[model samples]
Target: MKILVFSMATIMKDVSMGGSQRHLRELLFHLADQGHQITVLTNRRQDNSEEYELCPGVQVLPILRFKETFPIPYDTHPFHLAHSYSLIRQYADTHDVFYIHDAQMDYGYLHANIPTVASIKNFVYPEAMISAFHTNRNYLIVSCDYMYSCIQYTVGRVQPQITDQLRIVKNGVDLSVYKPVEATRKSQLGLTDDDFVLLFPHRPEASKGIVQAFETVRELKEKLKGPLKGQLKGKARVRLLLPRHFDVHVSKETEQFYTQLTQEAKEFQVEESLVFYPWVPGHDMPQLYAIADVTLCIGQFIESFGYVQIESIACGTPVVVSNVGAQRSIVPSGYSVIKVDYGDTESTVEAIAELASTPMDITGVRQFLDQNYNYKENLLGYEELITSAGKGSSSVFSNTSLKSGSPMDVSYKLAPWCYVSGPKKGIYHDYFYTYLNQHELYSFLSTCTEESFSQMELVEAGVSSEAIEKAIEDGILVLYTP
Candidate 1:
């Protein structure tokens, strides 16, 4: 099969460290190994490269239009949707099937003739679900049960027709590469055998809970000097291992963010316990995990799937994860993984302290991982779905097309998830599965009609002139014509 995969993540050292990016690369390589022809369409790196082979066979064609805005901020910039649409239009004809790594950018192939399957690897943003429900061409694939549940709650509630298009494919890890390690690189990392090392194996972003991790490290230091000191073998020293440097050139925003993080550590008086390290390549992450006493995955970031925590467990290390989002589903047995509430510094410190004396049950944890999150099973799942989707249909979208009319003559109605609710007059955007009090925008949408109406009719119907224009601009009122 000739497959075309679209991902914003480039095949670069800095970008490949992310879990979703790695998942895309692994799947492409696996399909190539099975004799399926695959070509990946991704953003060009800032350094400006055209095309390269991701593996020995799978071709990676980078879209040069994205070079200037390499890390396109989708929320702030319009290029994310525009570039995605343009890219799909340019290349959709040649490929038999389309696989998109990000559901948020799935707008491009909504009306494409070929089968398109897109994956959701983040907190189920409403825009993503809305895009999925708006089309029949795309199959919304989620990585965990939690993501599936998120969709089932919002979109599924409004549009039961989307049931056939939803799929759950669990994320997996390579056991051989991320296996148990008998020895740790303590001496090399300038740490003793006795020091309690807690690894924060994530990007140094505030959203990733870097600030909360810093506060926890400070509290851990205080605990070690008190009653918890006896639980350790030697001197009670707590080290919070953080990845400070990166392989790619740091942007001004990133540099400022890191500097602010460091400043916070100093303010908390835990600067002494903070151990900053340069970036470790993805291949060497197992070694990094093995050396830490407990890997910290606690933070404010709503994880779609906890890959770092799973990898830490597979590497024979216990993990302390925030009890939120998909982290709970990673280890159902709760064998080697410890759950703590997000922002609860005391519980986080205690979990790490408990693991100091009692080592993780590597044997049981590895068994659970092999049975559930094995990389082979993940690859095979994608293989089956893509093959079935490619052969099943020639025309993927519904027959319905927008009726051609003037801008004001286009029919507009409330989105399936959107409606006016309660005795109060307001427009609700069910994007987050909740009603928002948008009174001004509600004015026009409340008067929305399934049948076409001219602008003069809407104004004559007592709809505020400002509300009508705002509704059209915000997409609260959909139109078939420009």
Candidate 2:
């Protein structure tokens, strides 16, 4: 299938990246390798070269973005921007399906002329998603079980119509590229044989627990004062590997929070225990995950799916995360993974110390998780969805104008092939079946001949939108136009 993925900023990977960007980059790579003709559309400043690492063989098109105006704050969201709808509409007729990475983008506000699938990453602003339930060619994709439930709670409540269009597609990690400890982060950092590295790899935001992590470290280091059995060689002291940095798209609030964290770190006099790594190449993430004895994620916000925890576990790194959002499911208690409630400094420290005490072999950790989240398996699942979506785009509602030469044409009836036929079931499965008054419906179909349904006729029949959808799905009815 010819697929088009739309992302506002650069589709990023490797370096600490936002969840949506990472998801898109992974999807592009997986699908392109699967032989789909994929095109990535992005918004980046003018450059001499047009480069795309994620979609290696595909073309990356630069698009015009919404300009920030005075008085009104700059809308960084691409979907809400002026050109987003028009740009997407331009390509709607060409692509087989549209994969929009963000759910809150304004595109869903209008109907998609092409088969459109959107991944709802986080809690979308309600206003930005107006008319989503009624959107055409719209289908929703969720990565994890938690993500599905989160979207059901956040957006589903507002637009109940979305429930019918959702599909669960779990996130997959590339074992071939992200496999266990091929290289040591300790060796790269010049850490002595006796030092333990606790990696804090997260966005530079308060919600991400950047400061909370530092505070936890302050308390943890104090708690682990005694000798701790290191993952390697001998007794090892906890040395944190956290780079105080964020990419360009980071918010001003986040930058200020980072500054505050720096001040707090300086005040704590814990700089000696910190090891800062310079600009890390994107491909070195697996190595970084491998080097850490235990990856720390003490964020306070709700993570739809914690990718870092998955990547760390894949690299044979014991991951200890706060029991918040989807972290509990991602890093459930068992194996080498441990979860602590946010703000519980003592438990968080103890969890880390416990993992450090008895070294969990990198081989064992990798072996345990080898079958859990396979990238190829999930890629096939996505391909099935995309292909099905493209195939389903064949159906549309269309019609020709009806007229009365005598000026007495107030009557209408069902279109051709649609009739009071024998009972038809909704969807092949029984789950979507709506218990319609098939007798009344058949009577209505056989008798009604006055254009479309009048408000009175619909109300008298006690028909619902779902029943109508079920009727359409069951092939008891269909439109000449939609």
Candidate 3:
């Protein structure tokens, strides 16, 4: 199969820098290995010239170059839609299946009349985009069930017709590159053999929970101050490795945020415990993972599926993740990974303190990864689905259903607040009502307004707006459909 993968965020030369780029590169490589010809169409804004690279059977075509004049979120670049459309049109002659990364590029793919597999990387905007693209006959692949459910719930309330296209394909990690490294690499980074390093190798953004990790470390240190011995002492010296400047721009706001976080860590008197490193080179990431006892992925928002946790597990290190989205699915049971509820500082502290002493079974961790998170196996599953879809099969993937027992449910715990419906939008009101009660969850719920609801198809099976409104009037966290 000749696949044209369209991504607005990927710059071919900087594959290792961003999650979307890394995912594109890895998937391209795997597809190429399976004897499929792959071409990538992406924005060429990083440099003035349009560049092309031929890697084995895979080719990268950079087109529609544009420069940014002001600060904007990376995904919402104005030039994205125009650039993506022009490039896809330019290469439309040879492409087979169009695999798009983000929702913003749906317009381009729809214009091209391409049979696309649009993968939802985040819960936000996916519902709206899927609803808008409902008639396009595109397969909506979600990275995790958590994201799939979030999309279903959000879209079901507004545009229920697009639910049939929803499918779950959990992101996989390349173990060949992210596995355990030599002992010498640890010494090179000034990491002692005895140090219990807890890595937070994401951007220094507040939503990524870098600040929360620092605070958790501070609290843990304070709790261990008075005569806590042995295992607790190990936890007290917990090292936090935070990567500096992962964002495209180091804006004034970002600078202030970083400064404030650093100052707060200093105030907590655990400044020395945090180690700041420039973004780890793609090749050296395995070494970084090898040195860490636990990798922390504590995002407060609904992360589609965090690749860092899988990368950590691939390197034989456990992950301590905040209970959100697909992260829970990625770290399976009986593994070295631990899960803490979102925003619960005390639980995070307790998890870190406990893991500091527990001996990690490296072999067991590797075995679990091989069984669940292995890139080869996971990519093969993707290949089968893509191939089936290309062959005009009604069921492209066997487990396209976003039900809880699907393989995509690996990191996702059955949260009572979320539910998945078919490709057509249908509300699961029971879960929505429960989710709205929690103050934090309620904030996310409130974001769903009548305008948003207009995007989904409301089913008669769902709780009526009148009933929900009455519940809300009675001070209950009820979902208002309108």
Candidate 4:
């Protein structure tokens, strides 16, 4: 099957640098191995220049030109959507399926009336946006059971008609690329022969919990002083490797935090214990994971799914993650992975100290990856789903079926009718209100007619003259007004 995948950015050379890019690279390679023709659409920037060349069978097409934006980085702009629509329309003429990674591309493909399968990554979308896309029989793929549940809840609340098409496919990692490396690479990164190095290899962002990791390490170093002095004199050495962009905003804050912690270390007389490395190349990540006594991912918010945690586990490196979001699902129940409650600094510190004293079972970690997150097994599932969707039977709802009013009534019926004000001229807010008010509630009373729902309706309430129009141009909203 010829498949077109639209992604914003990817890091093919460095598996550790970004999660979405890594997923795209791994998924494309695995699919290509299965003999499917694949093409990727991404942005053209300095980092992405070598992006398409990383994979052999996969073809990379740059859709837009833009400067790099970090933290929430990408090359997607409003103009890119217009360009993508034309590109996808041309590709859809020959390609079997259009697989989209983000919402913008989903909108573009839906507008072109192309068959699409979209992976839901975020929770929020405008009601008009939902209605416009919901009419099309598109397949929605989610990463985990948790994410799938969230998508179901949100869609059910806003646009339940489209819920039937939702499917869950957990993300996977390529263990071959992430497994344990030889000690020589560790020495090259400045680790001594016997030093215990703890690595925090993520973008130095506040949300990623870099400061919390540093605090945990600081506390662990403090607690180890007396035991080291008395039991193993001259045999204790601990360091931290924080690879980050020098210009990244959080890097300055991280450096400041490191300075303050080092000062505290001096006051506590343990200053010789911590070290910092600003940025490590992506290729060296596997070695960094191998040399680390423990890898930390202390995220405060819910991760859609964590790639770093999986990457660490794949390297046979033990991980300490916060008990929030997908981290719980990503790490197996009895593996060397340890989970601490979010904001529980004391517990986090204790977990690190415990891991330092006890060695993790590397074999169990590797075994977990082999069984669950292997690239081939995961990609096969995606390939099958894409192939299935391409055959034109993958839609959960059809307009004809929805119009028949069995499942349609259940999906579209709204409880407790409410009045809507405007899809007034020049005001998008009024347009949405009027659209929901006129079509969603009134049009469903009799047999559903697309004309009645599509046309604007003028209604009078106590004090307002509201003009109701559909939110999405071709989409209809059925508001239930009592």
Instruction: Indicate the worst ten consecutive residues by lDDT in candidate 4.
Output: 425-434
Candidate 3 residue-pair clash tally: 26
What lDDT tens digits, residue by residue, belong to model 3 across residues 1-482? 88877665545465355565577676777788889988776655544236566468877766644322112324445666555456577676566777766544555444344566767566444433443344354577767666665655455434454566777776767667877886456565666655668788886557778767877777766766653445653543667777776443534565677789878888877788877766655667887777777778876655667778777777777778876556656677667778876666887877766665677787877777677666776677667766666666643222232333432222211232343222232222332322333332233233444322310222222535454345334433323222
TM-score of each: 0.77, 0.71, 0.75, 0.69
lDDT of 1 by residue, 1-482 (tens): 98878775566533464777778878888999998888777766555366777677688877634433323335344665576567676777888888877654555444367787777777444545456565555467788776775555445434544546777888888988898665566777788776778899787567677887888888877777887776755557888888864533635666776778778888988888877777776667888887788899887566778799889888888888875567756676457777865667888887876666676678888888888887899999888888778887423434333235665654454443345554252554423323446565455556565434556666777777687777655545544221
- Stronger candidate by TM-score (2 vs 3): 3
lDDT (0-100) at residue 133 of candidate 3?
40
Best by lDDT: 1
| Higher-ranked by lDDT: 2 or 3 | 3
RMSD of each: 10.0, 14.7, 8.8, 12.4
Model 4 off-target regions past 4 Å? 10-16, 47-54, 71-81, 88-90, 102-104, 108-111, 121-137, 161-163, 227-235, 245-284, 396-482
The ten-residue window of minimal lDDT in model 1 covers 64-73
Better of 2 and 4 by lDDT: 2
Candidate 2 structure quality by residue, lDDT tens digits, 90-199: 76668888776655444443335567766666533343234244345446777777656544433443444455676777777777767675555576687765676788
Question: Residue 415 CA error for candidate 3 (Å)?
Answer: 7.4
Off by over 4 Å in 1: 13-15, 67-72, 75-84, 108-111, 124-133, 182-184, 245-250, 393-482
> How many clashes (backbone N, Cα, C below 3 Å) per candidate?
0, 10, 26, 16
